[model samples]
Target: MSASATTRFGMLHGTALGEGSVSVHQYLGVPFAEPPRRFADPIDWSAPFEGGVRLAMRPGSVCVQPTVTAGDGFQGSEDCLFLNVWAPAPSTVPLPVLFFVHGGDFLSGSGGEYNSSRLAARHRVVVVTTNYRLGALGWARLSEGRANWGLKDQRSALRWVRSNIAAFGGDPRRLCIFGESAGASSVALHLLSPASRGLFGAALMESGSPIATPAGAAEELAADFFRHSGCGEAQRRGGQAVLSCLRAAPIARLWRAASAATAPPPGGGFLDQRTFASVVDGVEVPARPFELVASGALARVALLGGTNTDEGSGFVLPAVKRPLSAAAYTDYISKLTLRLEVPRANLSDVLAVYPPRPAADNANSRGNRAYLYRFDQRARDDTSEPVDWGVTHGSEVPFVFERGSWIDSGNTSFTPAERLLSVAIGGMWAAFASRAQPLPPAAWPAYRNGSEAQLVLSIREDATAPPPFRVEVPPRARECDFWERLQALVRDKEQRVAAS
Candidate 1:
């Protein structure tokens, strides 16, 4: 074969990554900088690839994470700092770009699972998936452990998109960032992180946020995680020895270690409120994003946020702990309401109004303009093992991409309605990326403080608000009042003592 023949067959991006392909164009894996032996490296702003060359096919490697133990579909690797882009074979209308940040509680999950076929095929858009450090590699903060390297990886990916995506027939200015779970939470963090301010225009947070975890608790979790790996011998102070051991050892061992975290199962977790999470490393995070949001220190970007009907039910099974009964829910409201510091009367009325789903509830229900939806559709996996997980954490993802195929010979059959809903959801997302607003009919309403108004979308064509749509926000959740009363009581006691 002549040199011309090689040129015609293979796809090449820039000179940085030689040449590669995966069922399509010149696929290139451009290394922006040398990855550190430890967790993350400084941002690599070097321009390794010349813009405009056709990118070779194949999605980027997923940032390394612990491997899956059981037959469950989880797997990972360390050489995962790659990013992949898919566009219409040969079009140049400056297509809208979609960047995905995979979710695994900032601990696991890769960008590999999400298929780009539907978005690339149906809407004529470019879809990019990237890998970021996960678990300890991404966010663990030992006395000397790297902090927010995963988030820095995200920033590097965005810089890559801004600089080169336009050459691949994508609009650099028109970008939509999407993620589920930790990815979603990362999106929230990005919104608040000044370093990530201009990386994306619109945002879609599936079921997580950066504000959920406090920094002090997260560092404690990292310290415990390292201790669990039996790394007390190293004088480095950081858990680097443990990190190095896990990185060098078989992937399974790391997964086992991560799974065996001293943190208990179910509610008590490695990334729970009381556990380690992406830390507020002064250099990278600066401050908790949730605090910024509460203080209105957020980017003025159009946002869309919502959760599944059983948001927390999948991770937390009631079978282990007794199901949350009505009385338990009442107790929950009384306690949480007190924490939020809402008036006792408001707590009673809000609890009376919103349907109690034990765990499934919206996070940002009031004081913002967010498009909200509840996915109630259930699916049955083709295999004998039923997939009746009701609106679980990841239930809506496959639908959005129609993973395998639609022809159901057995249990795996996506009805037309399901397909429509998926397309609508994806399309709505695409529309939001293209325009700041949502698709019509399903047009979402801007949120108002203490209001019950929100757009409730389902697979059904007609979009309507489910009765008592506003989720129940506990009073204590809002806790200043409690503090004020305690201070007042202290002052009164002091005054009486002075009188005596």
Candidate 2:
């Protein structure tokens, strides 16, 4: 295999890997946008490189972000708008292209964290992973309509791929954008944004919803951020002066101020307003994303997504480290149960679906059928954190990327079952990119109205056979019913107030 690949932008020197029947040309750290100004949107700059062979052997630097948790701080240039690509080395025809957005809660993550060479080679498709702005710098709302630079960065990267993937033997028209967690939420929001239409024909979001902050909430957060940075105090000096002060503030100082302002989620919940992830900015995000999707405004693209069996487990892992007692478990569950807003009498019902049953509401309302699945396979490695991570948030990422060995399960090797699951899941994702349907062996079912059936990806234990999976209905249908009823009541109350 050659050590380099030629792109119109420049001759890229990259590493080559052999997987299955093909070789993968893995190129890392390619820029797609110019260095973004503080609080400004990313500027598209994918011009062809005139320089000699560019070494894309390493991932580009991640954007600057403050340390939210221990061992989670990363620092890089503000010019972190870059992307990585993995393509089948020797392709006879153009293959389907997949653009991936990484998940880091809109705070921390990089396109360099994932290596998609195996997925590209095994599926005979091209895979692209990208990095966008994060935290305050990426999501802070400015005086004008400037906001959601991270999302804008993603849009620019997609445009770059559409224009250049053909050189890598990829069909731009058949592109699919997929991601996990915040990345998933970004993909979901893109579906609602006119700016993102036609950039990708389909989407696959994992464990996220298009829940952007309301305009008022976004404004409040921005104000708090300014106050924390002492920029609000500078307003007496004039509005322009405030902007200049913030822009001129050192990156570390800005990071600290932003980190201090954003409050952590209370109780056991993942939504954080101060994180200021996505916003309902009229330009980039035209309207309330859920309403837009519900009205069928953006329904042409196919959608596929689902939460894991223990999606909430990741949020509470830190609390249950020392082998929880019955009372402790109940306390943990109660704090989590409050988020669902069901009656205390129905708490049992809500707890039954903590993993959240896969619903067809997002796709079904648009009269478009979608596919849903529950990734319930628990990893055998539990040594990283003291508690049970149990198919927690972003747990499926390793399998999807076909790098099961990379997961820090404290184990150096994978079980036969784990390896098989990785191959199967990765293959399904590849198949979806190429055919728009996950080719599950037990016959993946297309979601239908009232159909809680989903492809459950779990290791089944049988005395006579190895662990494998089969079709199953959502864990608890009654729980889903209860929540829908509860949500309807809340919606009715809001509508009545609006009418009044």
Q: Of the candidates shown, which would achieve the greatest lDDT relative to the real structure?
A: 2
Q: Tell me the tens digit of each residue's lDDT in model 2 across 251-300.
A: 77777678767865466322332576888887787666655665666646
How accurate locally, in lDDT, is each candidate?
A: 0.56, 0.74
- Model 2: lDDT equals 0.74
Which lDDT tens digits does candidate 1 get at residues 121-230? 66667777777877666666654335777887887888878777765667878898888777877887787777788888877777665543446766566655655565
- Summed backbone clashes in each candidate are 23, 0
lDDT of 1: 0.56
Q: Which candidate should be chosen as best, given TM-score against the real structure?
A: 2
